[model samples]
Target: MNSSFSIGIPSGRNSSACGYCSPPGERSQGESSYQVAGFDAVQLTCQTYQGMIDRGWRRSGTWCYKPDLRASCCPQYTIRLDALQFKPSKSQRKVLNRWNRYVLEGEPDDAAASSQKSRSGKSSTEFVLPIAVHASEISNLSDESPTHRFEVTLEPSTFTEEKFTLYKKYQSTIHNDHKNSSAGFKRFLVESPLKDEPIPYPQTPPPYLPRQYGSYHQLYRIDGKLMAMAVLDILPTCVSSVYFMYDIDWEDHSLGKLSAMREVSLAREIHEAGVDNMLYLYMGFYIHSCPKMKYKGDYSPSFLADPETYEWFPLESCRPSLDTFRYACFSHPSHSSDEVITDEPDYLQVPLSSDDEKEIRMLVASGKRNFVVSLSESPYWQYDEIQRECLPCIHGLGIDLSKGVIFKI
Candidate 1:
C-alpha cells in the first residue's frame, strides 16, 4: 500500500477557552484565545504523520493541525517516552499487577487491595468489575490457571456498537461530556486517513490477534472482556497515542496510567520484533500550565520538543524554562519571545526552482494574495518551501500571510 497523503491549507481561526491559564469565570489577562491552523488530510502516510507529530502537529480524524506555539496561552509541547528504557515504578507495577490479576483470576489481588486502602483510604471493592461477557468472553472459571490468559489485540479504526457504547459511557461519566454523539465519537476516534499496513511480528501472535499497521484500536482484555481501548497510530519511527478511553466504572484501576504504560510496552515489543526505529511512545501534547496535564511529565526520562528548533530536550531541562513563561522556546537565549515576524527562518527555506519562482511571481502579480499552495508533489521540500519561498514571496507582495493564507505542503 502506498502510504501517501494530502493536506488542505490551514484555516479556522478561533479563541481558546483557556482552560489552563484562566479558571471558569475569570477572563484571561493575556490573550484569551489562541489561533489554530488546520489541514484536512487524505490518506496520510505513517512516515508523514510521524514527521508531523515530531514537529508539534496533531490530528482530529483527518483534520491535522498545530497550535500557534508562539501565541497560544497554553503552548503545548510534544512529549514522548523512550519505550526501551522504560522502568515501571512501584505504583505503576501495582496498577499493572492489579489489572492482570483481576482479569486472569476474576478478582483483585489481596496485596493490591491492602495497598489501595493504605494509599487512597478506599477499598478495592470500589473498583467495578466487568458487567457481562459478550462474544469475546472473559470468564471467572478456569480448569488450570493459564500463564498468559490476558490478551491485547490491535484492529483498524472502525465504528462498532460496543466501542461507541463504551465511548458514550466514558464521556458522560469521566468528562461529563454528554453532548458528544455517536457521529462525533466516530469522527474523532474511529475514522483515520492512514492506510492499513499491518507490520508482521517475528513471533507467533495470539490466534485472535488482528495485527494491522497504520492506525489501530488496541483492545486490552482479560478472560475475554474488553476492559480498555487505546487509539494509536503505528508508524515507522514510533507509536503515536491519539486518544484513550475506558470503562469509567473501572476508575479505581487507574486505567489512564496503565494504558500509557501498556503503550510503552507495546513499543518495546514492536522494536524487539525488528522495527528498530519504533522505540518511542508519543503521549501527545503536554501543557505545563495545566495542572490536570502535569501527570504526563511523571513518565520520567521523557523528552519535549522545542517549538522553535523542533529538537527534543529532556523534560527536566525544559521545566525551568516553562516555569518562567507560558511559551518557552528552548533553542533561543530568551527562552520566551512573543513577537511575530513575517519573514521565514533560514532552516525553513527551500531552494525554489525556476518554475516555482515564476508561478509565485504570477500569483503575486495577479493579486491572488490569499491562498494555500499544495506541496504534496514535493515532500522533501514542502516544509521548507512553505516557510522560505511561499511566506517571503507573499510578504514581499504586501500580503500579510499570517492573517489567513496557509501553504499546505
Candidate 2:
C-alpha cells in the first residue's frame, strides 16, 4: 500500500560550487549555486515524490532540494521527452546500432561497420524501440556466435560486492575518485526514500520489465561481467533518470548514449504494456548555458520547465529567452529585466539574534502529519515577519503542491 504522507525534516538552505561551470578545487565567486530550501527525507510515496519534482525539487539519496535558479550561476531547467514522439537522430541511431553490432556481430571490419543497419537491413524511421533495443539479445539462437553476450537486468538498489567493485573502478577511472567507500556509494546511489508502489498494469509485465514503480538499478553485463549501471526511479507518469555509471573499457561502445536510448525504450514499453501515462522520460536538469548539458535539448520535442510558472515549454522556443537571461520565463517571447524573480531578504548569519542564545528554554510545538495548509490563510500572518519566510516557499512550490506535502518542522 502507498503511504499517505511524505516525511522530511527541513534543512533550511545550502550553497555550493557550481558544477556546470566551476573547475575542480576552484570555487569561483561568481559561479556558485544556492538552494532555497532542502530536506532530509525519511520516506515518500511515488505520487508525492512526483508532485515534489513537478514543483522543481530534486533528490540526491535521501536529501531533496529546490534550486534557487534566479540567484544561481546556472539555472537548471527540468527536461522531459515524449518517448512516443521521440525520433532518434542519425548520430543517436548510429550510437545504438554500433553498440548492438558490437554485441551481436562481434568486431565488424571497417567496411561492414559502416553498414550498421545489417542487423535486419530495415532502416524505416517508424520503428518500435522495445524491438530495436532487444534485437541483439536474441543472437544466441543464430548460427553465428556473438562477440559479446549482453544482458540488462533490473534489481533493487542494494549494496552488493560486485556492484561496489564496478562503482569503485568507475569512480577511479571516470571521476578520478579513488577515496570512495562502499557506505558512501550506497548513500549516493543505492539508498532511496521512495516507497515501491504496484504499477497499475492491466496485465502482469514480462519478467524482464518492472511490475512496480520505484527505485531500481538497471545493471548492464557483458559476457557475465558488469559493464554499466543506471540508477532510475520508475514514477507514476515518467521514468526519472537519476545517475548512470559504466566501465571506461566499454567507452568505445557509446554506453552512455546506449543507456539513454534503452531508458527511452523502457518508458515506451511500459506505456504500451498497460499504463497510459508512463511514456515520458525525465532527463534531469537541463542547464542551457553549459555546452555539455545542452545535449539533452538535442532530443526532438523535449520540454523545459519554467522556473517561475512550473509550466513546460518546447525546448526550441525557450532557447532565446534562456540565452538572454540567467533565469528564463517560458511564457514570454524574449527576456527582459522584469523576468528576473528576485527580492531576497537581508539574511543574518548564525549565531542569529542575541535572544536566540538566551537562557529561556524554548517550548516544543508541532502539527499533525500530512497536513494541508492553504494560501488563503495568508491574512492571519499578513502583519508578521513570519509571513516573509513562509510566503516565499509557498510561491516557490505553488499553492497546490505546497499543500500536498507534509512539512515537518
What's each prediction's TM-score?
0.73, 0.83
Candidate 2: minimum summed lDDT over ten consecutive residues — where? 355-364
Cα lDDT for residue 35, model 2? 51
lDDT for model 2 comes to 0.72
lDDT (CA) per prediction: 0.64, 0.72
lDDT of 1 by residue, 186-220 (tens): 88998887766666667765443346568889887
What is the C-alpha lDDT profile of model 2 across 328-351, one tens digit per residue? 777654543323343463442212
- Every candidate's CA RMSD: 8.4, 6.4
Candidate 1 regions exceeding 4 Å error are: 1-5, 12-16, 19-30, 106-143, 146-151, 198-212, 222-225, 337-409
Winning model by lDDT: 2
Which residue pairs in candidate 2 collide?
Answer: none
lDDT of 2 at 4: 59
